[model samples]
Target: METHTELVEGEIDLKYSLAERVKTLTPSSTLAITAKAKELKASGIDVIGLGAGEPDYNTPENILKAAAESMEAGFTKYTPAGGLPELKNAIIAKLERDQKLTYKPSEIMVGVGAKHVLYTLFQVILNPSDEVIIPIPYWVSYPEQVKLAGGTPVFIEGTKEQEYKVTAEQIRSAITEKTRALIINSPSNPTGMIYSEEELKQIADVCKEADIWVISDEIYEKLVYNNAKHVSIAQLSDDAKERTLIINGVSKSHSMTGWRIGYIAGDETIVKAMTDLASHSTSNPVTTSQYAAIEAYNGPQDAVEEMRRAFESRLKEIYPKVAAIPGFNVLRPQGAFYLLPEVREAAEKTGYTSVDDFAQALLEEANVAVIPGSGFGSPDTIRLSYATSLDLIEKAVKRIDEFVKTKWQD
Candidate 1:
């Protein structure tokens, strides 16, 4: 046997080498920021993390009870690769009840999470170099997942002036022979913007004419606030329903992020392809999570509404305060739990050249964590999640205000 130094110096080291595909992938910026904050907290630093996308609320009690009962009854065995029948029925009921959209059992398939569902969908739909239209600023995962499926992400800008929503004309302009799909994340992550019903109708018309598939990510649907309503593009018309894939889960609404259950509802052929791919990749969403999701969908939704109220109250309370920060330009978000504030002026005033550098300094100096917007394709902005408690949100914002004021004065 060789000594450690000989082993290092002598032979080929294939074990540590990454696959080319893996090398090209970027780790999630949201997760990276959260992890660093966690590391600092572990090392006895006082870090207030506003970077995580998960609700600070615990998984609802009824859902937990359902999962516990499932385990006790030996429902711990392997389930169908797509999902349990009971859970699928619950999802079907949810669609008809909430969106007035109908989906057959064959048109729905469950996956480990919305992220996994999206990955599987991309895998089944994309060919190498096929282009998928994505609007900026997008969820960090959209472009990366498209690339992972050997698809190119063609981005159309949704400027702040447009409320961060790309128009139908923008979508029409991006389509080409290679265009295969377009992703729309309403009540979007990082931005909290929702496209109106009329906007969806026009966008759906463009997709229908251009023969492009629409991937509607409505994960934050339940979290809409004020007068905003989340209208599924799939509900626009029969033609739109035929062309749209709906991705959703209990993660946001039921606070079940760790439960790992999400699903896709779409055309039968595409759903079958996703199910078949899931059969190989994740086997099935965790059996317990499936059962819990059944209860989450079928159970009384008071808890869901309660959490929504809390988020809405917090959003109303904080938006004005955040916007009032000197040099920070933040629009009042209509839905979701995040605020995407353009901080380029703030950064410059604080003597930083970029928002990324300012975010780094914020973490080091003020011990507050926010995701820099470069990861979301908007380099002038930063994302701050309000999913945490209103108290923490207030404290974090105060720290930010003081930090910016002090730096600007210096």
Candidate 2:
């Protein structure tokens, strides 16, 4: 057996071994959570998991039918590395029709998922020491991906009071000479905070002055609740439109997480570069998945509406109940099926010092599972997704309420 040698002082040359860049890469925290949830479930534990970023609902029927039809028609061969012309065209049309931001098919590129597109864009566009502004509590992948691209990540932290959304002033405060990009996730993943059109305009104004590119993750664009408007930063003004990469997919909106078909629509130069990277990397998402994605984009949007309504109902229903839990302060979310709740009071009230401890105790004593806020760049909170069935959320919240009240009173 060949044994690996350990370095003592300086074993040969360490620089030639592995690139120092890859060493800084971190694992995706979202995947880390789902993996932990799976481990607990495999133990035959009744874990009411709220750690899932994907919707619990299955993909829509029309999408599945499209995949089946495409397969039957023998559309299984490898496609153009960038994407199928039909899918790219559909993406272009969607951008023009819905977003009112016109882009040619050349400016649209489909990848595995919105996450993949964003990560790849960073890889191709980022240079050493280029700064990417990320707002906290951001989607866990944003900062990691930026860092993996050898760019410095500048984080602007906000709290529940700010709705966990950053202001233009905050973005301005973080700007430096090396700043190259700014990521904005409207209707953000963990916090479910949606920025209004006016709010985006302010941020775009500052970004325009600084000439920073905007990577807008609009994956949850269709999931806003309370009739809240989800504004695309790119659509705010002509200046913003020229530099925005709008990312969207059928993952959350159509419950097609496994399908892995995501696309980017933006400036021709940036999108083409990203598309070329996609062509070389994964080579145009899966063929059948692209066909399915076409159905998701062009088919009846009613199913999307239904899912959004269901999530909204659950969000409203869970808020009061979750708020009733002693020491848990939940800000009603405007979009996405998540609640980034401050659980510090609950932890302190319950004699637990941290969110990880509180989350473990909840899973153990209450048989309820929720992602610790520590994973989402906030250690004093926990994310509660209302994407599951109402019965499960109801039962979990009840258990959580009972579990917290017995030990903590605040």
Candidate 3:
């Protein structure tokens, strides 16, 4: 047996060490850059942040009132681990009304947020060494969550010319016997691109033929612009619905990022497994937040439309200005409040070797914070969220434009 002193020293060493599963995980680059921007602002610096992937608007008044009413009625105790029955019914109704898809309460599992819902999903469905197909330039959490679940993430690149959306052929080529699931995030983060219905149907056929699960992340379903429509892969056919897990929340749609409400709609067996796991883990989603989400689903949708229009207007104003910058190639985004601009040539012209170095220089020199695309599996581009005011967007883009011109030309 080890001596007491030796055991105490071992414990001390282990205190600073993390689990093997999380040791290789990368921190979220978007959150990191946003934190740095906030830190700089706290120090009295003029930092223009375009990094956070959240709406600047507050949660709608009706939702807030619902939460307050629920609390006043003393409905604050823990509900079912999956979620409250009322909220599940609301989710089912919302899906049926919006997507023409029907789901029972047993087919839905609600968690802390969409992130938590996805994490729980991977935990229940993934076995060790199983592979999950993910597209490049994906959300920062997808790969990390797969790794945390003891699964490998296989990535296929989606080139800029394709609007950063991958094709079914690429997915077909990447599949193998070990493949367990494929993630499809329409209105994708870091890219703001949506896959069309035809494209989704093609992808769904491949998934069905290969016996793989389709994880459809539609968190930004309500944010499409330019008359673009958002279609769920689950809506393709009954077989597609049977094989797809629809993950969505009110965070982006209702401007309720802090409300901690998201749910997964999928097969009853898988949802039951996730609920059982949550029973031992989170116990339940926040009680008050669940009520707020119910109101968000059933209340007037004018606030949602208002926020969508505001984002669309901002996109129109900023897209041209950013695209006009020298050596920058920007794709006009069809959905979501983000702009991913390829800045490789601009970085080179400004004497930087890579976009990562260029991003750091711009933040330090111009006090403008944007996420380097290296973390999103694209090192040649950068992501800017236009969730702020139009004035801020203009000022930040102008500063970026001036920074490039002054360094390269003058």
For model 3, the stretches where C-alpha displacement exceeds 4 angstroms are 1-16
Q: What tens digits encode model 2's per-residue C-alpha lDDT throughout 1-410?
A: 95666668856655457876678876554464566667878998888887667888889888899999999999999998778999988887777778888788888888988889889899988998999999889888788888889899998997777889899999999999999999899889889989888889999999988998999999999899887988898887788988888889889889999999888888788877887777777877899999999988888888999999899989888999888777878888899889988989889888887788888788777777788877668888888888889999998899898888788755
Model 2: CA > 4 A from native: 1-19, 27-36
Which digits, one per residue and each the tens of the lDDT, describe model 3 over residues 226-342? 999999999999999999999999999999999989999999999999999999999999999999999999899999999999999999999999999998999999999999999
Off by over 4 Å in 1: 1-16, 30-32
lDDT value, residue 370 of candidate 2: 84
Clashing pairs in 1: none
User: What's the true lDDT of residue 184 in model 3?
Assistant: 94
* Clashing pairs for predicted structure model 3, backbone only: none
TM-score for predicted model 3 compared with the true structure: 0.96
> Measured by C-alpha RMSD in angstroms, how accurate is candidate 2?
2.2
Provide the TM-score for each candidate, comma-separated.
Answer: 0.96, 0.94, 0.96
Q: Give a tens-digit lDDT track for model 1, residues 104-146.
A: 8999999999999999999999999999999999998999999
